[model samples]
Target chain A: MIARLLKKNHSTEYEELLEQIAQGQPLPTDELEDETRPMAQAANWLAQRRAALDPRPGYVRASRQRLVARLQARGGKRPWLHRHWGDIAWWQHPLAHLALVMLLVASAFLSASRLAVASRAWLPGDLLYPLKPMAEQAALLASLTKEGDAQLHIEFAHRRLIEAQSLVFENRYEQLPAAVADFDRHVSQAVILVNQMAGDQQDEARSLATELQQALSGQMGMLMLLTNLTPDASQAEFQRLLMISEDGVSDLRNVLTPDGGDAQHQGWKVTPRVSMHWLGEG
Target chain B: MPDRQHADETRLVQQAQKGDVEAFGQLYEFYAPLVFRFLFSHLDDRLDAEDLTEDVFMRVWEALPGFRARGVPFGGYLFRVARNALYDHYRRNRRRSSDAELNLEWEDNFHPDPAESVPMNIEHGELRASLAKLREDYRTVLTLRFLVGLSTEEIAVAMRRSAGAVRVLQHRALLSLRQELERQESEENDRQTFKEEPLNGV
Candidate 1:
């Protein structure tokens, strides 16, 4: 009740006084009735205080110079790389420069890896064919253990078979010879590496060799069909590829079975469905 | 202010962002007094205010690179920095003393224009003493509004309050200040009466 009475009594008078002060108007003595005189006097006192409180000129000048000098000093201490790498003195810190170079090299290798992945579908005569094998070689180099090497070689041989088929379909006869050579090289490398394995790895190597032989037999059948359909000029090349694949299959079976007994009993022979159609006529 | 002057200040801020020390120095010159006034009013100590003013600008220099203007006036942003610096000063110095006296050294330096002088009997020492007794928010709003000449909207921006809230605070500050002055006067009158009664007893 008392607070409400005070607000009702003083709100208008106080508002007018504050407005006058805010507007930089002269406080009115004529309008000051006895009850409002204290407020008027307070407003005038505040105005006088504001006018009297100008910042000393010398202090302002010193603070500005000090702040500017401090800023310039801070700017000067920033590393050259943070400021700009164009400075020749960036090499002054050898480790930092080396780190920068390593970063750039890492970025370039990452980009190349992406490009190589994108080039996976490219055929022998395509612009990105070189990158395909380079990528394969990189994968092979990354895994140089005996089993890993054998597995990668088989993978590359499978890739070569696919490329040879693609070349035959595209009538890219000139590149088929190179593709066949690559296929034979990978299959031979996979068999030789598998044979060199010791005790526990021998069974794993035999299983991988069997899988490789089966893939080769399938490729050989495809080559036989392609040879039959190809014109006379390219028929010999496809026939050669078929022979190379058949020889690869025979070599894998010999490596797996090692005896002259029935290779089918040892489960090293190509399936009947794969070899029967091509071999029966031959 | 004229739009051209505002444009010039904006340009200066942009240059400061790009590590232009001269541009930043220009900003320092223009804002140092206002900042010093704010610190002086808040700290009420000349040396601490001066040191804290320097601290505020040094912070500004370090933080300028990341400071995006958006639509806030540079003055409002600067006062915000000043406010935070004062808060830090208080937090650091709060346990030491509660001396709330304003430095009146500037009174000696004040040279009012001859024509503008209206001689009044208001005792400035008692007025300052009353102002010092006010709540911190009340004193701050009064200083930002009257001493620093910020508009209510600008005070709202600097203080992070609504403009209506700032107006209410300003009114209350004025009322509280007047009431304090009245209290002081009544106490003085009582002291005078006590002294006269003792003389009568004698």
Candidate 2:
């Protein structure tokens, strides 16, 4: 039966000898000389070499004891968590460990998202205020597509402007700088993202640019009012921020109507609620 | 007999995975010789092989916790670790200018019985030298199959190859060794013939 199987499966000369061995038949001497001689010689040489330098029994015992000692030392010093959790049969399952890792990652993401939402209402003086910008940055990172990125930046700019207004109203003078910085960053990011839009998206981009210019013009009017309310030391900084916002509004207007059309005629003029000295007039 | 030993090893592996040091020690006793023979044959140096054998077991101990049977026998896993350790050893040695020198201190640490050492002959030395000349994969397969006494199926698991591939490698390795031996014989005969021929000046 073995010979038949060998004949079917293998076409090698050694198949006959293997079949013979399987059937308890002696290997013919001539067949051995013709086919198996070299292989037998090589196998014999390897076996002799293996036996010649087999590790001494004493060395083997010492090595085994050393390994055991090492393992025991490791086990003794292992942390309580590893010791308790490592041996649990379910914990040893690969899929179980994978699920545990996935659960940890999901919970971490959830906690970060919740923290981000709660941090949005914080003022600069609050501990979580710093997380607000981090949250905005996270939002920007999430909106990687070109289509939504400009809108996301513009939304964040509006949020920052509102935050600046609240900080000014509350007389939180120390927080004003961070709020102004956040507003500036959001406006700049919106401009850059809008400018990066493809030629086919020009009409939508121009509309978004016009909206940003109007929003910045409105925020400048509020900042001018806040500048008057600000103390002498902070007053100059607020005026500087107003000038920067005014310049940003002009840059967006230029991007929208690059051929230099009449501001009112082009419908890009935003009526400033508070009249102030035009920084661009100088 | 092999089936019984494999069953025993599987039980021991399960115990070792649970941090049973004694069971791991028994495993070490059982597998150390097989690993040593494989490394010794490939490296062609007894001391280097022994050191690498110890290193292999150390890694095995560290990794045993994450080891699942996954249809591969424990011996297969152990040898795979041994093979990787040997590869790392070779890579490190390649970066250094000095090859790993035989550690003479090994003899001082453990002395084998005089009777245990097989007397080396010219033919054995030639065969060892030729084996070293074979490609690493060929040498490895041949050592695992013959010197380590692993069956083709076990070698397939250890090497992560099909059993048929292992057989083909074995056959090719044997043929290459035969060719090397024949070439050496022809060269020896040429030298002998030249020596026996009288010089024209003489």
Candidate 3:
């Protein structure tokens, strides 16, 4: 019965006692029942013992100095190349120079490939996310044809659009603008690349433009769905991006049909040339 | 004063997050002793405590960039790190410890504050000794409560328990400690009596 009473009153009375001790308050008159005195006394003794625990000043001072020195040392690091550079004499030996060049190239290739693979899944706001775009740019430069470059740009735009949708879904609104901006840039670049082809690659260029129109059409539907889901503060930006996507899709449809009219106006749905997969679908 | 100190710490944490090593060093200065005392009370070894204190700060420095002060204070985060470091130390050194080491001299080596140079009484000494004999959770609750001066909520965050559970555990721990102190006191009395009775017989 006493234990039950203590448990019932613990939130108020005993808690007040604990709060008072925690605040270093002087104890009040002896109103605590007999069952509580021993615990209160134990608490008092524990508090007193707590006062006795003082870390040696010498240790504290010495450790602080050592830690500051270590922090400074860590902050003052120089580039490894600066430390390893020697006179040009080492470069005079062609074999040594060739081997060093090969080693540098091999290490760079391995590290870049590993970083690209590691950063593949990283989104905006991640430390490795910048590497993802750098890798995509490197891939764009490696493509041998304008059509190939346009396809790569479309692929990158698709990834960024998915990332933007994910940012909205995850409620990371701060990074949403960055992801949307990236998607806009990629889509714009893909359209420009498709428009640049005029001479012998015209047929393929028109086909790529048609594909771009289809993708943008599908993305327009996704963006409209997301606009309703986006928070009020970000709705304006989402609408602006949606308008840009609409304009791009209209411009591509005019270029594809050669009559400056949309596929819907021409009385036929634009069939997707590729796999026709949209974001968030299986 | 506490408000000003908290503001200063918040500013320092922000600067540290931005790669200011000096700001982090200042944080180390503020929290190192508390971390050391907590570690020492748990491990009962001065060297291990100091080493783990340094390790804990190093980790805090590395993890400062990701630390957001969303509801959880930096001190609570730091104590959590210290607890993890203590557990890691135990796992690594489990085979090296034996029961004999628990009785190592604590008061003899305790560096009392120069301003408060009052000598410890017998009860304080006995209490400190008996504290080492309690179970891990009891000792930890008491140490974080009294030595570290954490509130029940902070202790709950550190121990990953609810505030009510912490309160109940603390009450049980204090009762257990009182029992331990009584047991030690009786042992000391019986030993003294045994010594004096021989002289009385003589």
TM-score for each candidate, following the candidate numbering? 0.47, 0.50, 0.52
Best by DockQ: 3
Taking every candidate in turn, the Cα RMSD to the unseen true structure, in Å, is 34.4, 24.7, 23.5
Selected candidate, larger TM-score, 1 vs 2: 2
Q: Candidate 1 chain B: minimum summed lDDT over ten consecutive residues — where?
A: B116-125
Off by over 4 Å in 2: A1-37, A76-282, B1-7, B95-118, B121-127, B194-202
TM-score of decoy 3? 0.52
What DockQ does predicted model 2 obtain? 0.13
Docking class of 1: incorrect
Q: lDDT of each structure?
A: 0.64, 0.63, 0.67
Q: Please write out the lDDT profile of model 2 over residues B6-100, one tens digit for every residue.
A: 54888888887777889889888888878887776555455777889999987787677667777777777788889878756764564321123
> A-chain TM-score per prediction?
0.53, 0.52, 0.54
* Interface RMSD per candidate (angstroms): 22.0, 15.4, 16.1
lDDT of 3 by residue, A1-282 (tens): 334433633658777786666555655547876667777767766766654455665887788788778867877232343223311123334655565555456648677667655665678988767556656765775799888998998888778777777778878878876777677667766766666663357788788887777777777666777889988766655765674565455435434654323343347553323334764331
Interface RMSD of 2: 15.4
Query: Per-prediction DockQ scores?
Result: 0.13, 0.13, 0.14
Rank list by DockQ: 3, 1, 2
DockQ of 3: 0.14
If both were scored by lDDT, which would come out higher, candidate 1 or candidate 2? 1
